[model samples]
Target: MEAIYIDKHYNLVVECKQGSRKACYELYRLYSKAMLNVAFRIVGNIGEAEDVLQEAFLDAFNKLKDFRQETTFGLWLKQIVVNRSINLLRKRRLELIELEGDHLENIPEEESEDEDDVQYQVAVVKEGIKELPDGYRVVLSLYLLEGYDHEEISQILNISENTSRTQFLRAKRKLMEILKRKGPAS
Candidate 1:
């Protein structure tokens, strides 16, 4: 007996290319949750993030023909979602404020205020992240959470690499401050 073919990605792409709505929905169900997390981290709003996710899906479904498989489908889809999320930030006039020439040049990478006192809880961290200003939050989320390097982040956000690094550093410090105020993790 011949082995049954089971190329999920190939089959999904073929189905989607042939304009199967079910396949499209299947793709959406497969990727939307992770994509939503990525969008939410950047946009910092559930409604806006959902909007970005939907728009990304629309583009992905419609542009399925352009997906040449240079990368995996998930990666291609994520790129679209991230770009859309950044666009939403742009629509909001997300400003990349320059650092005010503070003495952050020598601040140790991992040192926080009273290092021994720092205890992070997931809830506390998410709240702290949400509290960050748009610039810092976007930089932090894109670089740390989304796995983009400084150069990629600079390009995505249209800021200098230095600015991206500075923003991440500032964001980390501010997050620590927020966590400290919230007290130790329970």
Candidate 2:
């Protein structure tokens, strides 16, 4: 078997768009893990994440002609993965809310807390996030872990930006409640 050395992913994309199955498969092999990670973070289930990954790759491959090389191929593919994951969440009929008032100003700034304490708190929060309902989990992961703004999240999830903001806030409050219930470890 000849090794397909893909130096630039866009090159592979160009080849794949030209109907090279090998190049397309190689593209999938190169990006599947990272894409899967993004999907898993959004969907919060191994099986569903895998489904999203497969769907994302298929969509990316089919839509390769639309790729303009402005961003790295991996980033473009990751966006597809994220969109697929969000779509899956929406298909589950999650109730997303748009904030009506000026609640964005109320979001607290990160305080200068101790590094170790922050790490511990983040770990605890992550555990709590895993316990969240699928709807909250997806929005929370996208906003917090993936660093998406409400506008980006709204576009991704097909909800209003205010809804994204509101879900994120509620998710945070729920996570904090869970952490409080867990209490300090001995």
Candidate 3:
């Protein structure tokens, strides 16, 4: 049995496929902000994110006929946005280093901080993410913020699963350092 996705905007999507400009606009209006946020998180620049958002919408509209609707339109658009954002990052020469098999196991683990003991403001956390290297930031955002696991991230970023896991681990440590330096929210 196939799982059916209950999309409330199915009518709008059908209308969009039929070339209804109003329906297309409505779909864009309904999804743009969330899609833009997805793009922004991956691309890490508002201007580039906006550019990606436009390109993603254009791509989605152009490919509307190919949409099978197995998932909600929002999820489809998000995939497009994420792909575009990653492409933009690639064009900017984002590099994800691959780790050797044994290197991961050899790295000494740092003492884990009790995250519940400290409070961080949203803006500060965002700033710390921005401060991370492109590879770390992308992996962290995709894994933590975008909810993709290391295996999915490996496929999405074209790296080994071990590499993805290593990047995520390093990103977490770096983010924690940044947050600690920023201190608890006052």
Candidate 4:
């Protein structure tokens, strides 16, 4: 059973790479829901997220040659989805406020003091993160949620690495502010 599942995935990728429409459909069926979740997380709007998914899949199919085997095909496709979602955000011309380097370094690292209630602390932090501005939200999602580094974020957003760092720091501050506004953290 395990081998058959693996073979199906591998064959779908190889056949899709070879321009087989049936393989592409199979791959899409397998990955689309997960890809849509990623897209919706980054884009935050269902309609826009769907658009990103479509564009991402098209780009992935077209550039199959460029995909090296450093990562699994699903991971590669997820990266494309993330990159395309970031591109869509940039196209909306959101103004990213550039923070100073010193400010970036000084972001407060407030680890939860109460160790007994870890789940509550995590829930508070998650809510705070969701309340951040769109730019900060997207940057935080790409950096922390999607596991992309500053250089990769720079390339994805066409901004400098410094800018990526600054945005991440600022996003953290914004999250803190949101948490603060939500009353005392228990």
TM-score of each: 0.85, 0.79, 0.88, 0.76
> Which residue runs does candidate 1 get wrong by more than 4 Å?
1-8, 98-120
Q: Roughly what TM-score does model 4 have, to 2 decimal places? A: 0.76
Off by over 4 Å in 2: 1-8, 102-123
Model 2 is weakest, by summed lDDT over 10 consecutive residues, at: 104-113
**Candidate 1, overall lDDT?**
0.85
How does candidate 3 score on lDDT? 0.88
For candidate 4, write residues 114-166 as lDDT tens digits: 66666787888777776777788888888888888989877887778888888
Q: Which stretches of model 3 miss by more than 4 angstroms?
A: 1-3, 102-120
Kindly list the per-residue Cα lDDT of model 3 for residues 67-108, writing each as its tens digit.
988899999999999989999989999888887663433335
Displacement of residue 8 (Cα, Å) in model 3 is 0.9
Task: Enumerate residue pairs that collide in model 3.
Answer: none
Clashing pairs in 4: none
- Candidate 1 at 121: error in angstroms? 1.2
Query: What TM value does model 3 have?
Result: 0.88
lDDT of each: 0.85, 0.81, 0.88, 0.81
- The true-versus-predicted C-alpha distance at residue 131 of model 4, in Å, is 2.4
* Model 3 poorest ten-residue lDDT run: 103-112
**RMSD in angstroms, candidate 1?**
5.7
Q: How close is candidate 2 to the true structure, as a TM-score?
A: 0.79
lDDT of 1 at 57: 93
